[model samples]
Target: MPSNSGRRRAGADRSPEPRRKPFWRRALRAIFVWGFALALLGAIFLGSAVYMTARELPTFADLKSSQNGQMIVVRARDGTELVSLGPSYGRWMPYGQIPQVMKDAMVSVEDRRFRQHFGVDPIGMVRSVMVRVETGRWKQGGSTITQQLARTIFLNNNRTFGRKVREGVLALALESKFSKDQILELYLNKVYFGGGAYGIDAASRKFFGHPAAGLSTPEAAIIAGLVKAPSNYSPTADVKAAIARGEVVLGVMAENGVIDPSEAAAIDLSTVKIAKEGNQNSVRYFTDWALPQLDLLLPETSEPLEVWTTLDVGMQQTATSAVKANVPGGAQGALVSMDRDGAVLAMVGGTDYVNSNYNRATNAVRQPGSAWKLFVYLAALEAGYKPDDKVHDEPVTIEGWSPHNSGGTFAGEIDVRSAFAYSKNTVAASLGNEVGFGTVAAMARRFGITTPITTVPSMVLGTSDVRLIDMTRAFAAVSAGGTSIEPYGIVKVETTGGKLLYQHRSTRGQVLVPPHVAAGITDLLQSAVAIGTGRAAQIGRPVAGKTGTTTSNKDGWFLGFSSGITTGVWMGRDDAKAVPGLQGGRAPAQAFAAFMRYAVKNRPVEKFDTELKLPEWQLEPDDEYMMGNPDDYYYVDENGNMIEPGTADGAARTGPASGPPRYEDGSEGPGTAGAPPPAASEDFLDRATGRGNQPDPGLRAAPRPGTAGPASGQRPPTVTRPPTVTRGQAAPVASRPSAAAGAPN
Candidate 1:
């Protein structure tokens, strides 16, 4: 109510408010709105571009198919074509001619929703992802049939995200352009079948020797199962494995409603008629065996390959003939021969690959019999025992275990040389005791025997089973001048165009056995062949070998070698039954002789370094009472007791009962003069005992077959009685200290 003139005066003093906003805030708001709109437009354009790019890919109708590449040829080291693995094509069939069962199998095993999906299956993808996440590996694959066809026709087989994206786009285009039947037809005709087969038609012909239209349910399932891994499930590679795969396929077919569960269950995969090809020759066995190795040499390859192996067709045939002729009708035999450097020259797995695909030479793990003694002897040598060192050939008990010879007769005290020559079980067991079982096991491993060896007393007698290949390699070590050898078959692999894919170079291990030690062992083995149990293995050259007959004659082995090569011959009933009166020297040794006779026909006669030159004193008899008194020699009379040099009972002093009789008549051989007649001078006894001062002219010590032992100052393990014996029973009566009760039968 103040007067207007007063209010107008007050208002004239106050300032008026502005109407426009500041420039910076308005500019910021407008910029944010415009930026968001541009980003949205860019995203839409990029998505459209991706879709358009995918749409431009080839349509299902325009999909091109190609014949599989040429065959992968396998050759021998001599450039001879041994076998071919590929491009064995058959007449192609149209979708109408193909079997519906085959198509159903493919859909069921590979893609259950082939007719329902547009292209890529989102549910399948999510499930695959979840499975992969759960397992931490890409174990599950979710590609639909269309997707697989797209990938196979246009994309390289690569596991990459980019490849997968392109595959999905192409799959979508394929679904859009073609009907389900047309897409399936393309897939059936373009997929790879194993064993040089290209499609369903080729696979049907290869497996059933018929057109695809006549494939049985089981046959169709087998063929479909091969899509995941053709080489693995091919009937030609493994008929049993292919049948097993078909069973899985049948289960999946039932799960997917492609076939009734009752019908699937009724399918007998074993009864399925698979066409049988002609009997494959022995060389096929070699090729089949080497195929896996070839795969390992070059794991991934797009082009055909040429695998060159170290196989001698002639040698393989020779081995085959030798086994077929010598092995008994029902028994099985395997022979493996390797070069000095462990190149597998020839391998005869069984009598015939057609009769038995079980490659005995490489796959069979059987007890090595006496062949394992090589490692035991090597262990003994390493433990400072000499071949000349004497161990009782009588019954021996170790930790309640008693080992005896097969002959059931023990020769009193015998040298390791004679014991090994005779294959005396008791002596070998005693040797195992001298050297700890652990040391012997280690020595076997060093020689390349991969089989696990236990620290049991019987281990000394080759109780553990061993692969022939591994055992041959172990022997190869001995023959190859003490170098470890890994037996190899494939020498070189190359692409068909002559590009070097792989070339094998001999990988020699450091000299594990000393040259002299090898020489010493070689001498002992030679004696075993020349005059001992391995006499049947005498091939008229300087061949060294050992014959082994297992307990109960269940197995026999003859392992022999020369400077040029080493060959192992194993023979036994596959059922592991006892072969009555079958000893190692009988059939196995004869086979060894026959094989060696041919193996060395073109090669020179190579003699082992049998010259073991030791000090004359080292070759003398190892007698505790006779060590310092070289002039004082005692001999055992008819009784087992030692007698003085001049005693009347000593007049009939005799060597150990184990020596071979020189004459059937009472008259003694020149070397055996019956205790020197007691009146003989000390010089004569020294000469008779192989203890002459300047090394007896008859005993060359180091070079002779008898003087194999420790180098110097090394003592062999002292022979001792077993700590434990059978309860409530006396030892068996024999030539020396009778066998204890409960001895190894």
Candidate 2:
């Protein structure tokens, strides 16, 4: 103001020294200038990031199509819908059709300032930051409903700062492009709920068996609660947890004034009825088993697929009923049924699928007991041994291990067929020794026993753990005339648009065993079911199978085939505890019969390719005769008189020795008196085959059945033979008893 010249010098001096600016004012000016410049730079950076992010956003049309696409649908062989996998969408509910209460509940619980915010809520963001700072953990999210929609549509749920920035820009763009109602509608239709359901309508129908338009307030609260964690809060997963979360949502609604506090308090959540399809229906086991195969058969694609499986609903129900009806309480059971071509027809994983989802049929691995003899005997047959080949059934010890028969008394000597029929442990062990353990393991591998098999003596006694499916598949191969087959549940896979992804075609199977070998194996199985330990499995029509009881009765198995279906049953405690009365011949055999009777009811009766001609032999002999005392092997008559062999009275005595004789006068035995009750013949036969003190070091605990065994390239332990010892001082007597017990018909 005082500038001009010398004249101004005086004026300037008089002008209060040019009115010197205050320090505070100067500092304020500098701060404002720098802040403006920094803000402009920040705006430019933010603008550049937004531009880059916008380019990555999907077109609106793409979003709409993705929301409308269906998930994979699985159907049974009869075109019955089994299950829907992946993100399953229901018919879209329009914005107007969405319930007001549902909207209010979501807004109140997820974001209270949803209406006031443009894309992000500043107040909510500050609150969330403060809470995180105070608690050192994220307690609240600052995202508005539009922001959530943006993230769902265009961004993954990543927590990186870059992702957050992208989410914010997309949210702003969405807010500018669409109305609040449209944003909410998209969110409701696109959000995922548990159990493969997407969108509010599908969630409502899946959880409550109704449409979203019909949702009650409590149901709306429950569905709103699912947004945070769909799986954890899903009603099907835990109804109590879902209801508790719903109560939280109700409380939030009340605090936000979206609902009357009294009304929120009075809401009856106890009456919620979850859909039964999610809880019951054991056929889900089959669906679960078959779902993974889709990945193997087809290329990955986002389009929804339609899968047709080999499941027979009728057979599945029958098998389920049979397993439930016969399995003893406190013990679990599993069953698998397949056709000759390895098409899995029915599978029951556990006694109650609702209580437990473990698929025992394909997953659980347990010792097969005598059921493993199938491989041993098959190896014997492959080694040129006939059904009538002589095998000693006496107490024979190998490498310090002595295997005993079920009653602890050997049958002395019998044909391979008779030994198999009676499930003689010594005979199986001897056969395993005769045909090398490696050969036995190779035979098992060839027949689809993919589990680790240590070439040890006990493996022949079913000591090697195996899955029920593998055993059933092996039996199926035999039923298919020795053709190798890989069990398959999926029949075909196609897109909903009818584009074929995969189709199962019946190819000529590799001949695993010669047809005559299978026929011979069938002959042995027939004799087993006809008069052997598996007699409980006999149906009127011809059937073949084997009975297996593991060590300590920990597992019981019955693998059999009738007509064209092969079924295997396994019963045991999951913890490997012995059930006193559990045996392959009792529960498992009975269950097999119950299922097969219905499984084969409609199929025409078909005889086995080979006739059942079992060798004539008695399974039990008198103690004296077994002890090498043929001269003293006499039968006592009704009058207490000794009868010689071939006598008229002795003709009736052709059957096995009942026991030590009881005289007409009530006296005890043939020996003078008090022969110490003659060491009561071992009455029960459920003993393990190889009884020894040495455990195989190479045998690790068997892995879960369906999983891989040892690490790749690992070799099984080498087989070492031990010295053999015979039990009695008297040599084994190969004499055939005069008794002519008829062969199995």
Candidate 3:
């Protein structure tokens, strides 16, 4: 019985393994449950995002009717429209009216699968992400055309996960609501194409000066390329860049079969006729200067505004022409003109607007050269020295810095007026030392010089860099009879509907210099043009000015003014290299004269003294180091010989009254002076002023023994000595130079 029971137990144990379940079936069941849960979660998250985004989405009607807010239409004071800014739009055309080539180019370059995608292109997004990850840079973007339109019309460009999610959701919503052509039309209408163009129609008009229907393949390609980086690829900014980008777009079109390779190749970028808006190109600098003011007045706009600027079209043209006329080939020039009230009438930032748009007149920082001496002289006047007061014009050493004249020639002693007129470096440095460099700099800053001025002796010679517009404004302060002039362009701004938003009245400000002090400066500057380095700028209507030539002729300038206006001209290589023989008296002065002649033609002739009377002041005694009277500095003969001072006419009158011999070296010595000065020089100085009695050229005339220098048949020099003085108080007469005394001024 025991053996039978054991056998039964063994049988029961062996029979138990019969009905076990398979391992693979349980594993498959577990995977199915997890997969279903994950799919449900993803669907729920996507639905929630879409529902949230949809709640904020606008209807098609709202999208179509939306506006980008008010634009600014800048007009000259004369009511001539200079430019229109702020989402400049063209006539919106239906999608059917757009050229097939343009549509193809846009789709190929911006979104290749535009017609196939529902909202966002999955392939494009993955490719963009992969590229970014592989290259560690966002070299390409993935937004489909619809998504771009959605972001542009309804969202900001912020790079955030929420914004991106919103963009994607909105793109999908738009796709569901509109047809592909409708979506493409909206995209083309809302996208920015640079140069104040928004939408394909506007871009076509802005770049090609025509409607979208008239767009050629190349032109369409150019506009299509601008979607990548509008400002960088704008045809107006860099035509070559725009063309290069267009080539890329054309390549894409050819690859996508939108256009045949031969057709794309046949499209020449040069054949694209870019329409030039005269007003926008001409006063581009004025617009740039006015935009900041526009922002300040209407930082956030809801409607288009009409801004009246102080630009005078005639003056603007004159400024552009003058710069082009005088700036040497391969050199850059800038000119700025402002009325006595500091209304900026004209600004020429570069030689040619097409070549460059850099507003050098307002933005470039260069050494003012002797033009900075105005501050030094003004400071001296403030420090109890009159224009007639004498100063030693010998070499000066200040803290181991010795300053000499351009040619190392020193005029022993000269009056303040003569020193300034002659632009004597030694005298300016010495005088700046006598007063303080801080005093000179403070005086300069008082007149609207924004550039940093170091408290060094050399600063007196304008070693500090300064903006041409600022310098012009500084002179404008003097021209305005001591009233501080805030150089401004925008005079009034209002809604296009004529609702007043902001208005700039010609308000007079606190006088920086006393009327009398400014008059003194005015007189000195007048004498500068009458008998100084700035003689080339004489405009016959009692102008006052200064000439500036930096070391090695790296920069040349003429800052000058009449009672009605102040103008500054700067000429130099963009690289700051010296131009052969460039000087303040040559190109810059001539440019200033040419610009002023045209700028003030309609204005009446006015005198500084009429506006500001001279203040009653006593003359101070000259320093012991000084040796002559204010009017006794120098008088030259036709032979370029310095005649000893003591003549009935105030100065020795030995030179012929006509065209005196022109000297190559700017000094009063014999050096190839028999020939007439370069026709360029003579014509430059004489043509604009219309005065027969222009001051002698900065260079002296060579003498013909007993016969006066060659005659050109002009009026005698009208500029006379300040006043006659006694022997000790008499201005030092220029002595005949001994051999080996020739030097360049």
lDDT winner among the candidates?
A: 2
lDDT of 1 by residue, 1-745 (tens): 7999999999999999887777988898888999889989976875565478567765544554355455678787799887777676566566787788898999998888777788888888898999999999987789998888877677877989999888887787777667788888888877787777777887888788888878888999999999888988888778888999999999999998879999999999988877775436677667667778866778577787888888887677667766666676678888888998878888888887865778888888888777788888887765544555556656668767887654354555555666676676776777776666787888899988887788888898889988878888887888877788888889988887889989898765779866656765776777677656676676657878787777777887888897578898888888899876566776677667666666767777776755422211111111100111111223222322333434544354345323232221123334446311111234543443345233222122223333343333322233343332353544322222111210111
What does candidate 2's lDDT look like per residue over 360-414, in tens digits?
A: 9999999998899899988876655556445666667755577876557654445
Model 3 lDDT per residue over 352-405, tens place: 776677889889999988888888887765554545445666655666677766
Off by over 4 Å in 2: 1-42, 48-69, 83-91, 94-97, 116-144, 155-166, 254-268, 278-280, 578-580, 615-745
Candidate 3: list runs displaced more than 4 Å: 1-42, 48-62, 265-270, 610-745
lDDT of each: 0.70, 0.75, 0.72
Runs with alpha carbons beyond 4 Å of true place in candidate 1: 1-71, 86-117, 120-144, 147-170, 177-182, 192-196, 209-274, 278-281, 288-301, 324-332, 350-358, 383-386, 507-509, 572-583, 611-745
Clashing pairs in 3: 70-303, 70-304, 629-730, 629-731, 632-731, 638-703, 639-702, 639-703, 659-712
TM-score, candidate number 2: 0.74
Considering TM-score, where higher is better, how would the candidates rank from best to worst? 3, 2, 1
Best by TM-score: 3
RMSD, candidate 1, Å: 14.4
Q: What is the lDDT of candidate 3?
A: 0.72
